[model samples]
Target: MKSYIISENRDSFLGMKLAGIQGIYVRDTADIEKAFKGALKNPEIGIIYLTEKAYLKIEDLVLESKRKNLFPLITVIPDRYGYERQQGVITQYIKESVGL
Candidate 1:
């Protein structure tokens, strides 16, 4: 399966493209929802990378997808500005699951 990215900025989209991942550039809730739905429907796409800003706009949908399916794992990635200093929710989940 392939990986896809959905980002809110041109720089982030370009960066992921450089890494050989196809992506969508989103500017609003509508774009985010559209890209996300399309990616989920694609059987070849098994993972989705979303920029932090983009994910925030559709956190509920992302989480719901995670709860309902195993493929096309939705991951929130840092933007061109870089990741937040604090621990992220996924990191916390990993730590708890692994007893870290």
Candidate 2:
């Protein structure tokens, strides 16, 4: 089994490739969804890493797969520019966790 990434950032995709992880650099939401589905369908894929942008485009689908406890863990990751919610990201996480 191997890990795959669905990224919208070319730099991040290349960097991950250098680390020996294969991935697809998606240009649009359609491409992101397609790549995500393909990754999910692959039994050889052990982990599916999605850049923030790509994950957001298909958040519901990913969540559904997670709830179903499907194979190949799905994870959301930041891009080359880092997290989109730079300001208050920690705060947001805490708030969500605390239900505040």
Candidate 3:
């Protein structure tokens, strides 16, 4: 159950890497798709952390994957700039799960 990160910038990538989470830096939709597909195919990867900016580009794909797979839990996290005012993906999940 290893964790991986998909970051939009080098800063975020390095930060997560320093925390011991292996990651890939993606600047476009194609790169995001590639990284996500690779992660999904790897059985050892059980958790995926995506920066908010990266997640926004592939939100539909991420949601669909989450609904279809039981492993490799996908999570969206804030980058160095911090979270947006709108609700985040994880926050939505938590609210739905606890019926809040």
The C-alpha lDDT values of all candidates are 0.84, 0.82, 0.84
Candidate 1: give the clashing pairs. Answer: none
Give the alpha carbon lDDT tens digit for every residue of 56-96 in model 1.
89977887787778776778778878766455767764653
Sequence-dependent TM-score of model 3: 0.86
TM-score: which is higher, 2 or 3? Answer: 3
- Candidate 3 regions exceeding 4 Å error are 85-91, 95-100
Each prediction's RMSD over C-alphas, in Å, is 3.1, 3.5, 2.7
How many pairs in model 1 have backbone atoms within 3 A of each other, for residues 3 or more apart or on separate chains, i.e. clashes? Answer: 0
Q: What lDDT tens digits, residue by residue, belong to model 2 across residues 1-100?
A: 9999999989989999999999999888888988988888888999999888887888777777776654777777788788986888778545533434
Q: What ranges in model 1 sit over 4 Å off?
A: 84-90, 93-100
Please, what are the lDDT tens digits per residue for candidate 3 over residues 10-72?
898999999999979989999998999899999999899988888888878888787777777
How many residue pairs clash in all the candidates, one count each?
Answer: 0, 0, 0
lDDT of 3 at 97: 32
The residue-level lDDT of candidate 3 at 75 comes to 80
